[model samples]
Target: MHPTVSGSGRLMLGFQYFLHFSVMGIVLPYFNLYCFHIGLTGFEIGAVSALRSAALVLFSLVWSILADRYSARKPIYILCIFISTGIWSLYLFTVDFWMILAITLIYGIFYSPVISFLEAFTMDALGVEKTRYGSIRVWGSVSFIAVVILIGKIIDLYRIDVILVLVLLGASLQSMASFKIPEVKRSRKHQAFLFPITLFRKEVIVFLGCAFLMLASHGAYYGFFSIHLESLGYTKTFIGFTWALASLSEIGVMIRSRTLFKNYSLHTVLVFSFMMAALRWGCLIFFRSAFTILLSQCLHSITYGAFHMSSILYMDALTPDDAKTVGQAANNAVTYGLGLMTGFFMAGALYEPIGAKGLFAISGIIALLAGAIFQTMGKRIKVFPP
Candidate 1:
């Protein structure tokens, strides 16, 4: 445990995660629906979504460098929350494709650093027992389940525009919560003018490559899963339930992540996560029945829950203390930024002619390839024991 972080502080951080992910649950899973509601075509929506990642790729490194240079994670985080909230609010007034694309790009620049800084804060607070991250992070999943279900019903009864109100509310609460977190102290020495290119050793490169492949595989699901379900005649309520089911399953994996870490190497866990992702996407290719969809979602426990936690721990172990924030930004830039950009753009182009089924089938194959690449890491990658 970090000497400065009290138990109450930990609880507050958990609440922050809860608030942040609540906003994500409302917006992320359904933003495509909102785009469609505002009259954008599938290709335009994908371009808008891809623009967000492009901004992240462009700006995350700049923000992370500033955070590390000034040792000001909390200040950067609070400013990002306010800026992103204001920019995101513009969505309510804009129906034009160009306008939405511009807003999303700007919003992504500010939003990119939020999670990376939070990860750095949380890891510092956890100290040596980094695996406990999942315990605190699981609250995010809980809030996601609650908000997704609630917003789904709200959209079902009212209109998708109501999601904007909920998103703004979550952002307001998150900004307030940011003030409660104590500023974490770190060494200001060894600040580099440029990110250390040498950090990309053979092992790190392989890990990041596999991570990119896995997230790229997720492009179809994240960008179009809800629309796909709706197209198949599933009700909004049922679609929300499926999302909640995945989060609920994620909670189980998160709560038990420490035990899993104790029993398995991070490499082992991540390889398994990749395999499960492959299987989950494979199932989506052939089976769209409610039961099969829900069953496939069960794999979220490993695909996201385990993969995310393990990746953070792995990165924490690999990077120096002074460079943690920048390290995390690099990881995010590769996995969520560039990787997701490729996936969204490709899925968008493929969605019309190839369809969701075909897109996911390709995703499954990519995930399998990612797993194979990770397997080659073998004993080269280090795993921290619980």
Candidate 2:
């Protein structure tokens, strides 16, 4: 493993995450609300979201391959940020469904690689002591909470259109932050270690499949949680607080993730996360009170925080150094891209017929299935030790 990165370098990396996810926390939680404000229906919103996921799936592999092949990540990382900033600005001028769809696709091309490449760069910077990844990544959760709460209040006082400005500002700052990450030098020795076909082994496939199901089950929450609250007569400020609560819980989990990794196998953590996800969604189906919803949101710690951190560590342990980027990309492609695409599409279809409660109940079932799949892996899968 390469020497542990200098303390300043680690801080810069953490700052980059803080900036990037700050943009995401603003955009991801509220984009559907923006669509609603603009007169788009649930189905129309779903179609737009699915297009974005499609772009992620289509381009994530291409970008990750390019990054891995050239042994370069920083340039692509910076390019993606600048380009996303430009594309997001176009939102100010367009509102037609088709036009919005086209822009989302274009945006996806540049945006898809952001997280996957960053994960690869971060893991590389941290080397074999990968547990420290959570320490740095938790900064993202902190920033996300700040952005969501602040923006929610702004939107409450002003209008949803202001989100475009916030998104643009976040993207601009993210581009600047990207410059602080030092370039990762690629060695010729590692260049030949491309993504291997053997990665499709049954255990790995099961892992990816379970990850996909877990993420897919989150479709209702990600795509429509804000709108659902709004329809229930909750204020935008309250909605934002609920979203911030999830990130707050996520922050607690990430802060302790290294210790969690120290005591449990990645497989064990994943199973626990999936189970918690199931319970969280189930609670969302039956509960509408503020207290219950806030309590349910706390499970975000297990559902996304622990699950995501565990998945990264698992991929790092399972993949060769040279193929790490590709591994991370594949994880993004399957779970975030394909899984999210499926979830949003289905939620759109089922939402009108079944309503939010039914949608969440279905999500609970899918989470249970995901946990079942992971259970089947059992001792066949290798566990990462402290």
Candidate 1 error regions (>4 Å): 1-4, 384-386
Q: Give the per-residue lDDT of model 2 (tens digit) for 54-130.
A: 88987988888788777667788888889988998999998898889989999999999899888887888887678
For model 1, how does the per-residue alpha-carbon lDDT over 1-386 read when each residue is reduced to its tens digit?
Answer: 24347788888888989998999898777888888778888899789878888887768878888888888778888999889988888988878999988899889989988887788888888877777899999999999999889888988999888888789888988987888875567767655453675256666788888999999999899899999999999988888888898999999888888898999989899899999999999999888689999999899989999999988888777776777888788788888888888889988889999999999999999999999989976458765324
* TM-score of candidate 1 to 2 decimals: 0.96
Model 2's alpha-carbon lDDT is: 0.86
Q: How many residue pairs in model 2 have overlapping backbones?
A: 0
Estimate TM-scores for all models: 0.96, 0.97
Q: Which ten residues in a row have the lowest lDDT in candidate 2?
A: 189-198
